[model samples]
Target: MESTKDYRQLPNSSDHYCFGCSPLNPSGLQMNFFADQNTVISNVTIPDHLCGWSNIAHGGVLTTILDEIMSWAALHFIKRITMTRSMNIEFIKPVYIRNPLKAEGKVLEITGKHDAVMEGILYNDKGVACAKSTARFAIFSPKVAKRFGIADDNSLNFFANVFGIK
Candidate 1:
């Protein structure tokens, strides 16, 4: 069964302007995600402006999407702020512009107290894997993220509310 619980974006007061998941950025991807058990999924359609060659989605944009989803996966499952330490992507087929696509992410393993490995896959409208990614993420607690200047107070508050952190 599919999960109906959607991940909420940071409030405007957080000044969130991520190119991948921020809803307030006019030129951003504005992707939204939901959780299915331990997996995070986003359904998106690449706009014409992000195309690379003719109708194909840009490789950089595809990479960003994969990174974003995997980051979210690590955040949601590991309950921490996540940064991509390293990543690898494999493009199996072209993702065409102006077409429905699905991106899915899941935590493959938590290697240590603060490190995780996650995988993301982008699927075309036909449910074929168009791109695949595996990433190592560095995870930090909310307080650690705030102390390290990775996230401001408002952003940390938003995450605390959503993830039930104190």
Candidate 2:
């Protein structure tokens, strides 16, 4: 698939040490993402140290990838801060370490103003789906998130700027 041209690269803050997308976390996945009309996507290769059995990528790490991608999808498309309320994952095939993979997330539906249903899928280099996830997220505006103290000032400001919140 095409990695650019049609897709816009999403930004990440240097202030937070997120295990999924942070640049400052030495042991983190350091994944980056791009956005198109319908979805947010990430391409990455699992490191050997993150393997569960032999060269197979761990289920939990894969879950983290799905969660992160889905969260970003909610943030980008819904223009809200999100927290995972529930999720279900299916392991369709094995994902090997050191092999390139793609993870994608998109909003399936928005329930009311506060909740969204998201879907995340992980694919191998050959484009075979290795795993899938569906999740419910509790979305919050930047102002509400800041008031609730769930997100710090740096993140709230970044979201506010990115989403053009007044």
Candidate 3:
């Protein structure tokens, strides 16, 4: 099947250290996120080390990809820092190592100034849906951002760039 529409890759700060999207994480996924309007997307291949069964990708890893993409959707389109408050994932099929996979995330709704609902999906090489997820997030206001060390102007600017806040 055809792939997702071509999208622009988002930016990350020099000090960014996220396990999923950080280029600096030597052993992490180092996934790159791109945007399709309100959605965030990532295409990647699962490595052996991230697998569960002999050649099957771990559920945790798959879940992480979902969370990362959805969180990015919120951060980018919603322009807020959010944490997953609750989530449900259904694994439809086993994802094998070395298979090209795609993850997609979209903000379903903004429940409140500090709350949002989001959805995500995982597609295997042939574009069959292998997993699906939905989640609730708690967006951090400026006050909460301070407790997380993201209150500084520089840090906010960095996040704004990462999320494409114009």
State which candidate has the highest TM-score: 2
* Reference-based TM-score, model 3: 0.89
Q: How many backbone clashes does candidate 2 have?
A: 0
For model 3, residues 1-166, the per-residue Cα lDDT tens digits are 2255678777766576777888898767888778877778888787888999899999999999999889888888888778899999999998998889888899999999889999999999788999999999988865578678755677776776665443
Better of 2 and 3 by lDDT: 2
User: Whole-model Cα lDDT per candidate?
Assistant: 0.84, 0.90, 0.83
lDDT (Cα, tens digit) per residue for candidate 2, span 12-67: 88888999999899888998889999999999888888999999999999999999
Model 2 ranges with Cα > 4 A deviation: none
Report the error of model 3 at residue 14, Å. Answer: 3.6
TM-score of model number 1: 0.90
Q: Against the true structure, what is each candidate's TM-score?
A: 0.90, 0.95, 0.89
Query: Candidate 1 on 45-90: residue-level lDDT in tens?
Result: 8889999999889999999999988987776778788899999999
Ranking by TM-score, best first? 2, 1, 3
Compute the lDDT for candidate 2.
0.90
Q: List runs of model 1 lying over 4 Å from the truth.
A: 1-14
What's the C-alpha lDDT at position 58 in model 3?
A: 91
